[model samples]
Target chain A: MDKSIPSLAQAVADIPDGASVMIGGFGGSGAPIELIHALIDAGPRNLTVINNNAGNGHVGLAALIAAGQVAKLICSFPRSADPRVFNAKYLAGEIDLELVPQGTLAERIRAGGAGTPAFYTPTSFGTDLARGKPVAEFEGRSYVQERWLKADFALIKAEAGDVMGNLTYRMAARNFNPIMAMAARTTIAQVSRIAPLGSLDPETVVTPGIFVNRVVLAENPAQEEVLNRQEAVYP
Target chain B: MTNPAMIDLEAVKLTNAQMAWRAAQDIEDGAYVNLGIGLPELVAKFQPDGREAIFHTENGVLGFGPAPAKGAEDWDLINAGKKAVTLKPGAAFFHHADSFAMVRGGHLNVAILGAYEVAENGDLANWSTGAGGVPAVGGAMDLVHGARRVAVITDHVTKSGAPKLLTRCTLPLTGVGCVTRIYSSLAVIDIAQGRFVLREKVAGLSVEQLQSLTGAKLHIEAPVTDLTAAQVA
Candidate 1:
């Protein structure tokens, strides 16, 4: 089935307020900036965003947060290169945060996509992050149990995509995009180029079409770090 | 009592670059290693000649090379520290799940990290100070326990001259009984049998002088070698 969409705004128009979204990126590498901006323009409220970092300067995710679209942030690092936006909101008690270790966060999203309910890991076993969680010992080693994290929607970026929604990402940009695509109810992808259906090599497709619901073209998308450097703020 | 004047000279303490260089010498060839953000990132610059270590950044890239020249950076290619990077010839990219799986699944050879404090019993505290601010714990907790061998590189004492190698960590921990070795500013020590085993100290520094700077008792096991590094131009 063809999953290609015409416009960024239309692709994100259906996302409602209070939705839990998993935005793909590790500090802007694979962040779906256009899709995020589209969602911001669509004007959703009370969103709980899942990302590696909360946001950098006043551009992408920070702009979304500044727009008052996010109510909570679920991430590993809230303090980014420039975390002024998140810091202000958090210190003022205007937003909530659920901090998870980076590996555990990735595993939780993987488990959610794979239909696993819960799993045990040795990470954060005796720290404040593991407090209030059930702990069990296996073979003389203790591990804390973490639950799966599924989202209402996932916004992701890709290097190349087909109308069938098969996606491939470039270099380090592949960080969370592929897994976030599977962990959400609906996955919206912004690709730099839309290749023909048969053009993508089957063996190299990082995310198959089955997990993707919508694909939009975002050729020459703005880089978050560059935008932050230019001190560009969104409306 | 520690003699401050006797230990304050550059000849007695290893510089940050020397400490990183000293730590990099121990990495075996063909090992998969993860270097933590700040001080640990310097380790990549001094990999021993004829030995190649594949660098793993938690962000997704494996086999990443040094930073690209000015204006040659691709924003999409960066390290776990979110700094611009370039890929080596044989580099591979995967999703975050697989990247962290390489970390949490014990597929990495060594993980070098910066420490705020390390207990004699091998406990590590580097993530937070429990201060009144936003607490951010990145992939540190996982790297400490997951890598096959965990080593820390840091100044032996705090900037205010307080001992960082302690009998017990006063701050929150990243992992319990996880660290195995430390390359500090003044010495190379190993954490074994719940004691600080002195392996090496900087040239011209006496055992008593080094001991005076440490929080815990330094047990003399083998003859301490001079902690030295090849001078980098």
Candidate 2:
């Protein structure tokens, strides 16, 4: 079945307010900038965004937060290189923040995708972050129980994608894209190139077509860091 | 009464680069290591001549080489610190889940991190200072326990000259009894039996002088070696 979408706007148009979204990126590397801007233009509100960093500057995720679309942020690090946008909103009580350790966050997403309800980990056992979590001891060591994190939608970027939505990411840009693709109900991928069917090698497809729902072509996507370096702000 | 030997010993504290170099000497070859941001990152530059430590960045890629030249950087190819990097021949990329699986599954050999405070009992506190501001923990909480061995590299004292190696961490803790070794500017200490076991100290510094600067009692188990590093230009 062909899952290719015509435009970024149409792909993210159905993401309503109060939806939980997993935006793929570690900092700005794998972030789907065009799709995020399209979501902003679509004007969703009260979004709960799960990402690694809050946002760098006033371009991609920062722009979404600046647009007052995000009601809460579920992330590992909310402070970025230029986190003035998120910081201003969070301090003013305009948005809520749920901070998870980076590895735990990744595991939760993986567990959510794999249909595991919860798992025990030693990541945040004795820290402030582990407060109020269920703890269990195994062989004299304590482990905290962390629940799975599933999202209503996932916006991800890929280097190449086929019409069936089989995707391949570039270098370190593959960080959260593949896992977020599996964890979300509807995964929307923006690819730099839309390869022909049977073009992407089966052995090399990081995210298979079964996990992705919509694939859009963004030939020349704007990079968040470069845009921030230019001090570019969205409308 | 000014003791000239004491003054000379005080002036010879290891610089940050030298401390990093000293820490690099301990990493076993063919080991998968994670170097935290800041001072710990410098350990990558001083890997011994024959030994190689495969670097792991939480962002995804492993076996990454040093940073690319000024204009040669690919923003997509970056480290956990979000700085552009180059991939080594054996480098491989994976999703965040698998990257962390290598960490949380104890597949990594060592994790070297910078710290705010380390208790004599092996507790680490590097995430937050508790001074009313945004708190970002990143991957520190996981790395401390995930890696087989956790080590800290930091200045012996704070900028105001307060001891960082303490009997108890006053700030919030990152992990409980996780750190095994510390590579500080003043000394190389190990946490064994809940005590700070002095293994090495700055040359010419007396044991009494080092203990005066430490917050906790420094235990002398055996003959302490002089902490020295070959000068790197």
- What does candidate 2's lDDT look like per residue over B53-111, in tens digits? 99999999889999999988888999999999998999999999999999999999999
Could you tally the backbone clashes for each prediction?
0, 0
lDDT for A199 in candidate 1 is 93
- Model 2 regions more than 4 Å off: B1-10
Give TM per candidate.
0.98, 0.98
lDDT of 1: 0.92
User: Residue B118 lDDT in model 2?
Assistant: 98
Model 2, residue pairs in steric clash: none
Q: Measured by TM-score, how close is model 2 to the native structure? A: 0.98
* lDDT (tens digit, per residue) of candidate 1 on A8-53: 9999999999999999999988889999899889999999999999
Q: Which pairs of residues clash in candidate 1, taking residues 3 or more apart in a chain or in different chains?
A: none
